[model samples]
Target: MKLSSSAYLRAAVSLCSLLAWTAGAHAESVERAPDAPNAAAPDAAETAEVSGDIIVTAQRRDEKLQSVPIAISALTSDTLSGRGVVTLSSISQVAPSLNVKSYPASGDTLSLNMRGQGIADSGQITKDGGVGLYIDGFYIARPQGVLFDVGDPERVEVLRGPQGTLYGRNTTGGAINIITKKPSGEFGGRVSATYGSRDFVRGTASIDLPAIGNIAVRGTIAYTDKPGWVKNQGGNNRYHDFGQLAGRVAARWTPSADVTVDYAYARGRVTTTPAYFVNPSFVGSLPGYVATRDQTWTALPLPESESNFVDHQLTGQFDVSDFLTIRSLSAYRGSTSHQFVNYSVALTAPTFPVGLTGQEDYRSKQYSQEFQLIGEIGDRFSYTGGLFYARETGRHDKLQDQFLIPFNRHVISTRWVEAKSTSYAAYLQGTITPPVLDDRMKLTLGARYTSDKRSATRNSLVNGNPVEVNARNSQSFENFSPAATLAMQWTPNILTYVKVSKGYKAGGSSEAAPVFANTFNPEKITSYEAGLKSQFFDNAVTFNVTAFHNVFNDLQIDFVTDPANPAVVSTINAGKAHVNGFEVDLTIKPSSNFSVRAAYSYLDPKVKQVLAPAGTIFDRLRNPASPFSVGDDVTRYFTLPFAPTNALSVSGDWTFLQFGENELSFHANYSYEDAVYTIATAGPAVRGRDLHASEPLERVDLRLTWATQLINDRRARLSFFANNVFDNRAAQFTIAGGSPLTGYVRQAAPYSEPRVLGIEANIEF
Candidate 1:
């Protein structure tokens, strides 16, 4: 839907007016309380002193979450453990406006979408998504290892909207910051073990050593083994089974009062069977198809997949003076993955096989460096400036074999791709509190200049003979992103802000077989946002709301050009898109023993214009059964992929009993997402049929915990948790697989995880 500029302006004004009136009325009522004289006046710290208050570094500085002008969701270690969230897939249940999906062939590959912005195909190595992922302030260069198990972290912060001004490249959608626990000066440790459904078992351990001559050390290790949720009738092996092991070591040195140094190393390995695929039974028109059965596959030729990665980081901080600080961060990372799959369900003839077998291997290495300076001037101005540099190199090797049973024909294709990139950026941001309005108004401005150079080469072989399918290509891009925010504190417990920002994602070469279609233009977004943060009822209730509108130019889109040869995918600069959304987050602590949290989001995304490629067979095809046709604009007026119109999450925790240092608590949460289209198309018409889409997702989780004192003043806790309690059988991803020439098109989909119940035990010393 298209929204006029005047309409948005009016809505923003109305929202601000309502917030102002509400804040004034609340303040007046508080002042008129009978015990107002005895109660201390609420200050910045006092107004945010509730249990819901959290410290965040969203703007590259330490501040209260209510004080940050941007929209963000922070998940602490306690919250993660309580929710049984171990990976990014489960994180979406609690984070509104975020969705994560894996490919049908491989579960390790993840596509992350936030606020209608994300890459449709995450398998493209050369192209980066609009959202950025960071671990310990260092960027993760690839999506392959994004699902690695993160041993207990201090917190995970999800920043929504454009963050390019401070975070630099590829943050048009937003950023995810994973902050691990740092070494403490005192000795501490924890151990945990879990046993769940499907014979799943997991164990984790951590240890921290006391300061030794101004140095402290900490280490953690975790391991998990689980059987597949799906049963295979064709082979003895199961699909989607996995085993993983991960470890991390960190050390901190504080030899002087003003100097500090920290170093960390992490490594992990995972081995799992590829996800199983089955023909869609719901389509009754197709011959020999049956619905109403569990996810079972009759054919399995390949079952092994592996992924591994190692990361190292070193950081240093120096207090130049009371008003200035300098920090340096350096990191290096490497990863490798191997995937094998067989995508055929049945045999078409006695002497021939109708199936496809594929094998792929990927390896990557990267190094990055960053330096920053932060200063405060006379309590009126604070500024942060940084310089960043990163270099990455990677290789991808893929082989595919297709067999036609009826004709007894076989075809083999192989592709080897190599890529390298270098990026440099400089950014600066400053916040000033004006003398007017008693320092209640603040102005923030920031900008970043980025330069990137990337090159890639692809060599293809058909039936064991080399072919010049695509030529080597090199490209360079430069971008400037700017941000400005105006914020005012209307009351001690209320703050409102308006912000405008620009974000950019660098373009890169495509691996398509066509020699002439090797490059795409950069994607950019201009965003405007307004938000309000307020607290009432003596800091027991906190509410935050934000509305945003974004305009995207030269948006990059990836899709299959030909269904017959499904191995090669094409990338194009589709056109412009307009996205507008609103989000609400609320926390209420009705009593000391009970609390509730809820989040909701509404999004409307539409393609405003598009330029189609001429002379394409798929575009010009006049078949009524085809999704595209002659004179059709493939992208115009189409809804963006992975965008859900409405999403909601509600959670409540109740502590029913507490007796002499022992406590018992119950927690439950519910999450819902509207139906979403997995692929982008014009009005869902492909081949005169409806496009593939995912069903609405609804899930509920419950947890019960008991805690008591252990020996030697230590503590011990036990918990029982259940996820997807209702066993919702929703599809995570769906697509068309079989060739259309067979007189029947086959639909394939991979379902989400089933219900799981587990028990966990933890001991702290």
Candidate 2:
């Protein structure tokens, strides 16, 4: 519902000038010979023996996601098990510029936004997340456990903009590459089970082993149990429940073939139960509020959450000859979390017993090492050099038990935050081609130089002494982040590109900013991109488009230092901002059992400079200190938060019916979102009372399949699924938790996720 970027630049200059005038009327329109002037190609794996685009590693090598000129998306594993994506927050329903959002009182992890960047209160363990989550080449330093459970997936590349030279630093709102599905020495197995609707149960299993001598092994296990739908207090228990168990094991050794090795072990556990801040304006203007906005509304010592993680990884490769190649990655990770939240939804217990309950405990550990050197200096250019190291340590503690209604007293606040970080990076990238227009132009340049040393500490206690909180222990940052791209292969299937990148994110320390000691710096992004990767008539149809613009400097913001005390928070540096976007990905596959896909995204956020607090000006008055007003420049009511101005996803995959080898398929998906704000609206009277936007959603997913062959030559499937199919209840998140000085402006929600229907059985051996 927001579509004018000059009609998307006149439909991308009228489809690249009508595909360059029909490829110059196809007099055998050629142009695909590039690679070898800096070299870098070959490293396939996109099934069907490759070449339908989608073979990515988003620049750390393995090209062909339309030659990787940024703006990427790849979601296979049969399109994420046909749209029922498991975890990673359902992959944003199909990656339309991604946006994940769920911080359920710090439990199930999630809160990633792409286009306009993200992170507005995302399970902060001394923050640092502008999208960057990698697994398989490890690096998940936080966001809890990144929603664990991704048992069998062999693809999930999202990389949109600013990957800062082959993923360095926090990727400035981009990077997610999951890929998990290694170990292929031969024999295999898979199993799946499901049952749904609140009492939902799920199971998954996988195993593969057959190389015996050169070694090969794989294993996976997953389990999920769901319960919960509100109700707590007088209902005994329940409040958005979920439980999970996940596991992974792997080993592979090529032993020759120029040496290759891999080792992995992963473990996971997740549990949940918090969600009910449901203040529908306090039902009847607070007098005797009675539960009513879903889940039978109740609260009190009933919310609980837990997250767990463990991973050990190692990967190595060496060829040393095809122009030299060597890569290695090592990792170790550990995590633990526990939350006992009840943040709201109290039914006047014994004279408003101030229900601000929160108990958190988190612990983390990490170690990473990476080294890469992909070579070629003779064939044109092709180069990559890397060295990265990471070290992390964390411990967070929170315990608060409310009741202070204006000091009629009862407190227990206790908090202890600790963080330690050390990082070092050195990267280099080069790509060449330019021998003339015959090489179809290519030029890539990259850089990364990062050095960070972060340290943090926060200590506070209430009834047991120790108070003073405005803290920081250490901080040091350095960044380089540079990139450039200029591609053009204009016709073996068309390709075009233009890019410029720089991204960084360092800043640390802010367990909800203890009374504004205010220390922030290190966010800086400068990106510009242009894209088009096409295919027509013969490849059936695949179109990709992108257009982006970003520029934000020190833009970390998290406000509400007491909007009537919603846990009094603060994190700033909200100065200078910009975002512009456009993206579209379409697929058509006209034959081969029918297929259709669509994805769209468009965002535009603005706010150019806004660092206030000296003399009031950017009016956003509702007075809880007028949203920190002072001397203009809250930049016209800044509104970037989760950044969501139009997002869409459409799907279709039909395979009517086949007989010779038995088959039947159908999958449908529809996703839409356009309403996002998620907090922060700084001027113009607080965006005319913007109650922390969010609540424009549409979702639907369906699946039906039946592939057959089982009985030993295994390969079977039987499914039926339905997710959110019609039970669309909005409120994807909105908060301002009432009380505009008791004038009550309402809003405090967290909804979405209701309809569920299931039946699935899968096997593959």
Backbone clashes for every candidate come to 8, 9
Index of the highest-TM-score prediction: 1
Once all C-alphas are superposed, what RMSD does model 2 give against the true structure? 22.9
Model 1 lDDT tens row, 1-765: 423324433443443344334433443323323233222222232233354567777776668888888899988777787777777777788897888766555666778889988887776678788788888788988877554344467778899988787773557788888878777655556767788998887767776655566787878776667777877666655677766667888888877878888899998776666666555543343344343235454535655677888999998989899989999999999999897777654212222336677888889999999999988999999999999999999998888787765667877889888889999999999999999998999999999999999988888888999886545888899999999999999998999999999998889866764653468878999999999999999978999999999999988766455645554566777778889999999999989789999999899988886655432334545223445554466554345778889999999999999998799999999999987776665233344222356778999999999988864445788999998899987765656543222222445656667898999887766
The lDDT for every candidate, in the order shown, is 0.75, 0.72
Q: What TM-score would you give candidate 2 relative to the actual structure?
A: 0.33
List TM-score per model, in order: 0.88, 0.33
For candidate 1, which ten residues in a row score worst on lDDT?
37-46
Candidate 2 lDDT over residue span 1-765, tens digit each: 323324433443443344334433431432223332211222366453354556777666676676666688888777787666887877887877898866767547678878878677767777688888887657787877554445477778888777766664557888787878887655555667777886677777776545566777777777677776665657545777766666788887776778788888888777776666566545665556664546654435674577888888998989889888888998888988887777654422233446577788889998988889888878678988888889998888888877666456777889888888888998888989878989888898988888888878777888888785635667788888888889898788888888888888888757866453455777898988889888889989899898988888878766554544556666667687889989899989999799898989999888777665431222245343455455654565566777778889899999899997688989999988887867665334453345667678888889998888844355778889988788887775676544322322556666767788988877665
